[model samples]
Structure formats: structure tokens, C-alpha cells
Target: MNRELQPLLDEWAREAGVPGASVGILHDGEESLLTTGVSSVDTGQAVEPGTLFMIGSTSKTFTAAAVLALVEDGVLDLDEPVAKYLPELRLADPVARDTITTRHLLTHSAGFLGDVDIASGWGSDALAAAAARFDELPQVFGVGEVFSYSNSGFLLAGRVAEVVSGLGYEDLVRERLLEPLDMTDSWFLPWDVLTRPHAVGHVLRDGKSEVAHDIGLTRSLNPGGGLWSTAADQLRWARFLLTGQAKDAPPLSDATRALWRTPQRAAACPIEQIALGWMVTRHGDAEIVRHGGNVSNLQLSDFITVPAENFAVTVLTNGVGGGVLGPKVVDWCLENLAGLPALEAKPVVPTDPAEYAGSFPTGDLGFEFTVRDGGLWARMVATDGTIETPPAFEVAFVAEDVVARAADTRRPLARFLRDEHGEVSAVEFGLRTAQRERSRLTA
Candidate 1:
């Protein structure tokens, strides 16, 4: 481990305003860990490499790999509709029900709402039930039309795995992925985490970094973002991904592993596109594949892999404020360590007289876009009421349909799409998408 990086890690944690955080870096298959801060304010126990952090949506990578493993075994078909495996599968739109396939789900083009607004502990049968209840949720886009991040899609994918393997989602992953990788300490349940040294999620309550009420994701969604792991285990996972090889690589073939890293959908933003479980993008000439996981107020984790340089970096923190720690560390590693130029955003270039006015609905959040200064401006509102929108910012054009609010560049990038009439139809705001609700603000 590069001990010299400790100070910077400590600084990043403090900036993120967390009790403690951990970072894992892997370059050329070598690993280093820099852990700082406390696991809990109540205990004041220093964070350790063994302490588990809930990795949130990064678990999608695990789930994706498991399904790919079945694909390799001739038990699953990537092109076939998920209903083929899970006979109970249904969605709100019958077209989506018939057209959406495993490929669409993996690529985030299945048209299912990103999330079903279902809480975590709906019981052991929760994911299966959630899959059956998709018909109750809205379909934001046509099948394969846009990339909308879908937690529900991954869960349904897990269900397909369950049907093919006759094993629970967590067990299938544990038996197939974890045991092979020799990750002894990682687990999908909070009960298992409690048996080991683990960190509770910290939240910013009234501008204070305090322990969060919920330490783990709802029990059923474990396949989506429920795994709790240490920095060391994450490094092991990164190393496996970096090499795309394992001792017994039956489940995920080399070709499928490469497919997991390859972009499956075209991007409307500055990024290249969304791969199965990774975000495939470019930083200068070097390709970067990464994913960030957030349990909203509880925890935020990030994993980045730069395959060209054989480099990977992961940041896991216990609170919302510390979300920036992962990418910042990534920028540092690539620039100073690898002699690579990290991606820097071009200055905000305001779009010309775009009619993004009025509101659009996503599963959870809605956006009210207005014409200001002859340019497009957007104020986002959370339907779940978890966040409050600040003053509107000018939506900057980084590409034809891709736009980003200058302040929050981490994504859920606004992608403006056009109809056959060549007019802006709807803008995809993150995973939750909405069409225009009105031309002018509701008076």
C-alpha cells in the first residue's frame, strides 16, 4: 500500500464530512488501501480494511456477472425476453412486456421505470413479487429507446437467475462469484455484516455527520445495491475485473466479461455509453469504466476501472456528503500515478433557444424546465421528497441531446430527445425520466 496517500484520503473524507471512509487502488494488478476516520461516531472505532461498507448499486456488477455465468452455461439467453425464464414477468405497458429482453435490461433500455418505489424489506420473495408488480409502474420510454438507469431491471434479472439456478439471488452470487474470488468477509445481509467489524451509514442531518437510521438496504433489493464489503474485498473484485480471468471462469466467459465492459447503448451525454454493469467513458484517449452507488442519505460507493492502464480505484464512504471522494481519488490516481490526463468538463456552453419549458415526470423526480435568458433552465423536484431543488441552473450542451447542470456533473445527465417532427419530446433526467408536463410553469 502507498502509505503516502493516507493524508490525501484523510483530507477527502473530512471534505465529504463523514465519520470515516476507505479507498482501494489497484494498478497493474497490485493493490493498495488507504482507510481513514471512524466507523461510527458513537463508538469512535477507527475504520479498518476489514470493516464492511454497503456498496449500494455497485452490486449490479455482481448480479450482472451471475447472469452472464448462466449464459455461459447455456441456461440463459441474453437476447430472449426475461419472461421466457420468469414466466410471471409483467410490466405496465404490454409492448414493453413483450419487447423488453435481457439485453435491454442489461443495457438500461428496457423502458421499465428505474425504481419501483418499493422499500427494502418486502421479505424473501420480495424481488420476485416486485417483478410481477412492474405492470403497476410507468414505462418512461419505448423499449431500447433511451438509457434510463433501472434498479428494478437488475432485480428482475436476478429473478431470472433464481429461476435458472434454483438458488436465491444472494446465494447464487455467494456460491458462484464470492467463493471463487475468495472474498471471505463480504455478505449480502446486514445480519452477516453485524457478525464482523462493519460501519454504519452516516447521514448529514441538519448539517451534521451522524449515524444513519438504516445501516443496510431493504433485504430484498440486495442484488441491486445490498452487498456489504471491505476495501480489500472490493480490490479483489477489481483485480478479477481488470484481468477478466478467474480460477474457474465457467459462469462468465471471457467474451461475456468483455461484453460486460463494452458499451451496450449509445450515450446522449459526454460519456461513451452505459455497459451492462459499468459506465464506459473516455478520459482523454484512455478508456474509463466506472460505476457510483448511492443509498441516498446512507452511503455512497464508487468503482472505476481503466483497462488500458490496468488500473482500478474504489471509494466507499458512510454518508451522502462524502460522495465526491471516489471520483476525486480516481482523478488523482490516473493523473499523478499513471501519467494519464483525466477528463475535464468543457466550460458550460448554453444551448440556443431550446424549448425545454414546463415539467416532465420520472418515476421519482420531476423537472420543471423554463426558458430563461433565451436558454434552457431546469429545477428538479424529488417526488419521493428526499431532496430540495436549489436555484435553477442553465442546462449546458455537451452534445446534441446531452446536457448537464453545471453544478452536478456526476450524472443523471439530462438527455433531450426529439420526435419524428424534429422537436424536443422529452429529456431523460438520470434513471427517472419525464415528458413535458406543461409549456409554462404552473401558475
Candidate 2:
């Protein structure tokens, strides 16, 4: 692995204003842990390898793993409709109500809202109550259609595990995945996190870092992105996912595990690629299963595994730029650490540059694609003037309708929806789909 990861991490932590970060790598049965920055910028205490940081949506993989374990035991069927397990659950749409299955939820094709921002007031029935309101969530696509990321789906899946096992979701995870794997430094509550050597999440404002109000995820949303864990524990989790390199036997069957790792196909028209609970992206001949989390854009985490090489990397940052840090670290690890063949970059001009250029508006904020030095560039603009965004990042077309930055590979970011005549009509950006406007606006 990168013997100089310390200096490289120091540079990134300084540049990104990260208060604290822990990086863990598991390669060919060996594990290494490293730390940089401080647990608290306010106190200036150095961060230790055991210090806990929120893993965000990366927690989704654990939720997925636990469900798969249940599947292995025949307690749950992958194709069985979720309503078979949780009868109280209801969707805004009836078709999706009775038809959506465990498969849909894990793959994020349940066709409901990507996020439900409402939280219960800390009751034992918090997850259940929040799930009941799921019927109020709007449908973005039909069941098994588009691959919109859904926290509500996983939360519902967690409730299913609770109902089937007659155990709390937290406890179910503990018994099934944590205890068996021996991850003692992990936590699921803000209070528990505060009691340990923990890092507080930070948001940047006016060129300064400030503590985030939502330090940890709510109890109701625990299944989605609520877990806080050390980098060491995270690497162990990654090691388990890389079964060949795993220290212990996998908790799920090889067939079931292989099924979960494969990229899922969208039900409706063609859509972007997302594995059951992770992202399966191609880097030449190698396939990467990775997941990233954003805890209110405060704490950012990413876990990635390259199965062929028995390699994995987990990163958690208590800062705003956690979104950008993961790709940089993973690319370095894959190429420099694992010695994987790096995909060479090629310069290609779009057949019709204006076809890819337009005003893609999402509510009040939008993106404007323009030519910069004859290269395609995407810029973020505040249409209503409420917030100021950074300057545009240079994005180049890497494939048909796909774009990539030097540090970014997920592209089309949102697939560009087409009109009847094949002109770009709308663009899907995760949960927020924006329309193509006639003229572009600037901040």
C-alpha cells in the first residue's frame, strides 16, 4: 500500500479543511490503519486510529449484508414483496404498494422518494412510524424503473428485518454482522458516539469550518446512514465483502453474495448502474463495488473493494469535501497500491457540442454546460441567488452521454432524459430531476 499515505493524507486534509480523517486498507489478508488531522478542530486534539467517525450511507452495505444473511437462512426471499413481511407499510401508489419486492428496495428501484427528511421524536416505534408516512412520498418512477438512491427504501428494509427477526434493527445488525465479525468500536447513536473518542462533523461557511447541527443521523434513519465506526472496523467490513481475502468465512452463501455484487438492471427504460446496495463501476477489466455517504454533507465516508486483487479502502472525513476525497484516494489505491491497470484518458470532441450544452435547472439551482478552451465544462449556478457555489469543474465526455472529471468517474451524474425528437429534455440528478431551459442563467 501507499507507504507515503501519511504525507498524501496530510496534504489532502489541509487542502479540504478536514478536521479529522481515518483511512483503512485491507490487501491480501493484511490490514493497515492510518489517521490524519484532529478529532476536533476546536480542541486541536490529535485523532487516534480508534476514534469514531460517521460512515454515512456506507452503512447501507451493512444493512444490505444483514438482509442477505437473512436471505441465506430463508427467513426472507429476495423476490418476495416487502408487504409480505411488513403489512403495515404502504406506498403512495398502489401498484408499487403491493408489487415492490425486497429486490426493489435493495436496488433502489422502489420508485418512491429518495429521502424523507422527517424524523420521529425518539420512540421505539420511530422507524415504523416514519415508514408509515412512506405512503406520503412521491413516486419518481414506476417500480423497478429508475435507480434513484433511496434512504427510505433501506429504512423500510431495516424495518422488515426487525419484523421478521422480532429484533430491533440495530440489534439485528449487531448479532448478525458486528458480533460475528468482531467490530467493537462501532456506534449507532450520537450519545454513544460522544462518549468515545469521536470526531465532530464540520460544514464550511464563509471560508471557516463550523460544527454541523446534525452531528449524527437520527434513530429513525439509522439503517440508511446512521452508523459511526473507526477506520479499522470499516476495513474489516471491507475485508468481509472481499470474501476471498476474508479472515472469516462469509456469512452469506457464495451465490447470494455474488448476486448482491452484480450491477442491477433498471426496470423501465435504460438507467444508470447501481448494484444492490453498492455501486458497480468498471475500470478497464476490473470491477469496483463501492459506496459513499454524506451525513448532511458534514461527515463523508466511502468504502471500495476490488475483489480480484483482494483489495479494499475505507475513508471517513469530518469535513465538507468528503464527497471529493473518496475518488482521489480510491483511484490512487487501485492504480498505485493494487497495481491495477489504469485506464488512459483520451480527448474526444462531442459530435454536436451544443447538444450537450444547455441550462439544466433543478428547482432554484441549476447547471450550465459550456465550452472552456474547447472542452466541455459544467458549472453550478444559483438561479434564485440564495447561495453561492464554487466555480465550474472541468468535465469531459468520456463515453456516450457520460462525463468525467479528473477526480470523478460517475457520469452522466444524472442521465439526460430525451424528448420525442431525441433532443435533450430533462436531466436526472439523483432525486432531483431538472428540466432543460432555453437560456442559461448565471450567479
Candidate 3:
């Protein structure tokens, strides 16, 4: 299997301009790990089997899983208002503060601005301190009104875990999830990772891959996306998700595992549904539960699995554009390794592409869509000076009111949302609903 995957990994890493990457696969009751390229452009270090790469939001699954374990232990209830656990917790909106549930947090439907990142401190009170600052985060939509990805929500969930268990979030996860799965190489702190072989993140600037900022994630965000793990450890995690058994770790009951993959709310196109901690989708005849993570344009990671087939694949890359390599590799693995054929989209030229043209703002970044060359194109605009904006890229309607980048239709970029009058009012991009600014601009 490595013979078949190594060449593809090498070729795809080069094509994606990623410095280094590691691929892990669980196939037909066996496992395979393949790696390619240097860990960093400057250091020229080879990526080894145990080299750790930050898993980013993929850590959310473990956070959600830990919350679910607490639920099963009768320590907490999923539907209970989060205010029950953290009575002092406050949001910018009063109602949301009182009514948001742990379930809402797991499904990312808690509905405030989901992108808030606060570095409270390296102390044990980090999670709680960071969450306390959430009063400044304005509510973008009503509680559970729609599916918007919330890193903030997970931090709250982690804090709840900390409070209820009387253990720190990292300790709770290590005891409840990671240790059981035998993911011993995965670490959440920078100090822990720095002592081991780890991959440094890289970013592409002016067509050259350069080493990115190496300071690890803030302690407060660990529950959301701060995991540093190896490909083998990630594959072990995938195996546990696939079969829910670890020789040394207590198993999460079958019922709880099923609930984790159960659809909690409807998401936009490409993503069919949002489960407790997993994104559910159907590609061809297989149901795929997966998640992808990016750390501020530094590292990229993807984890995908087909439960019915007991097949899983994880791709960990060390560069910004490296994420593109994941879908390509997954497509190949599904076809050749898992025997599932690819599903191609047959998109059409919309009659009035102008209807989708407008400026849609979400937090610090926004997108300006325009009609050009008989199609819709979008340029990412920075709403705040902190954001790095990208050039305009063409997109196509893969489904009604949904657009994906023209180059990769399988990855939906934004889904248009209509108000009561049946006109486009906003867009759900990156899982956050961005209200549209009216305009008749054409490029």
C-alpha cells in the first residue's frame, strides 16, 4: 500500500507546493503510513513517522468526544443550558447566555461570532479566563438559528468539562480520550511538543514556501485546535473511531459513538450534516464522517473515514496551500484503496449570476462577489487590518444557492442564504453567516 501511496504523496506535495506531509491510512484491518518532503524549508529536516504536526480543529473531535463521555458518565447532560455548569458565563447577548446548551456547542450552533480567539494566559485558568472575555463577542445570529462553526463554543465546552470534572481540560482529555486510544505521541502544550520531533508550519509567500511563526497555539485554544500529533497516532485515533475499541483504554459505549456521528443539524452544501463532533456526508454510496483543520494559514490536516467500510485516511501537511493535497489523496484512496468511485458535479451556468453578486461580511474578513465571464467570482476582502486578504477566484453553483471554487467544486466555499422575501440576504461561509451588503457591481 505504501508503494502505491508514496509516489502520489510525493507528487501531490510537490504540486501543492507543500514543504512536507505525512499520510496515514487504515485499510482492510491493516494500517499504512507514508511521508514525503522536508519538515521545513530552512531546516531541511526529514519528516519521520513520529514527527508531530499540529492537528488544529481536528482536536474538536476529541473535545466533543470528551463532552460526550461526560454525558455518558451521568456527569453532565448535553441538552442542559451551559449556564447550568458555568453560571457566571455571559455572552454579548443575554438570551444566548442563558439558553445555549452543550449540544449546541458541539454542533457549532451556539450562534455567536464563532471566530473569536483570546489568549488568556498559560495558567491553569486559561480556558475559563478566555471564555470570560466572550462578553465582547457580538452575537451574529440567534442561538441555534443556523450552523456556524464556533471555536468559542468549544472553549466553553472544554471549560464545562474542566469545571464538572474538577480537572483541567487537557487532563480531562488525556485521561478520557487520548490515553485510552493509545495516542501517546499527541501533545497539547508547546513545551511537550518542542521536546520531541515535530513539524514546523510553513506559509507560501511570493511563490516561495517559508517557515511560518513557530510559536505554538495559545493554551486557551487547545480544546478547539491545539493538538500536536503524529501520523501513526492519528491513524490510531481513526481506528478507535472506526471500531470504538482500545486494548488499554476504556471504550466509549457503542450508543455514544453512534450519537457522535448522528446528524445534529443541517449544514451547507458539500457538508451534508453536522454531527456531535463530526461532519457527515455521502460521497457515492459511502457515508463519510470527516473533519479538516487549519491553524491560521500555518499547518493543515484532514481526517476522513467511511464507517461501513472501516476505512480511514489522515493527511497532515506543513504548509498553507498544502490542504489542497488532502482531497486529491482522499479521492485517490477512496477509488483505488477503498473501491469507492468519485462523484463529479455537473454544474450549470446560472441564468442570473448577478443575483449572487454582493459584498458579504463575516467578522474580520468578507467576500465580494461579482459577475464576470458569464459566471460568479469572489475576492476575499479584509474587514479588519488583522486579516490577510486573498485574490479573486472564480466559482460556480454546484447546488441551488451554493457556490464552490471553480477549480474544486467538491469543496463548497459559500452557500447563499435568502430572507423572508426570497432574495439573497446573506451567505454562510466557513460556517459563519455573513450578512450581504447590497450592490449591483459587475467585474
Best by lDDT: 3
Candidate 3: where are CA atoms >4 Å away?
A: 214-217, 372-374, 380-390, 438-443
Q: Candidates ranked by lDDT, best first?
A: 3, 1, 2
lDDT of 3 at 37: 89
Per-residue accuracy of model 2 over 300-389 as CA lDDT, tens digit each: 888888888888888889886776666567777778888887766655436445666788764345668776566666766656553335
Task: Extract clashing residue pairs from model 1.
Answer: 56-225, 69-251, 91-135, 92-135, 120-218, 359-437, 361-434
Q: Positional deviation of 314 in candidate 1, in angstroms?
A: 0.4
lDDT, candidate 3, at 165: 88
- TM-score per candidate, chains pooled: 0.88, 0.86, 0.95
* Leading candidate by TM-score: 3
Q: Kindly list the per-residue Cα lDDT of model 1 for residues 224-254, writing each as its tens digit.
A: 7889888888888887877755546544667
How close is each model in CA RMSD to the real structure?
3.2, 3.8, 1.9
Worst 10 residues of 3 by lDDT: 382-391
Candidate 2 C-alpha error for residue 193, in Å = 1.2
Steric clashes per prediction = 7, 0, 0
> What value does the lDDT take at residue 225 in candidate 2?
88
Off by over 4 Å in 2: 244-250, 266-272, 348-394, 406-414, 428-443
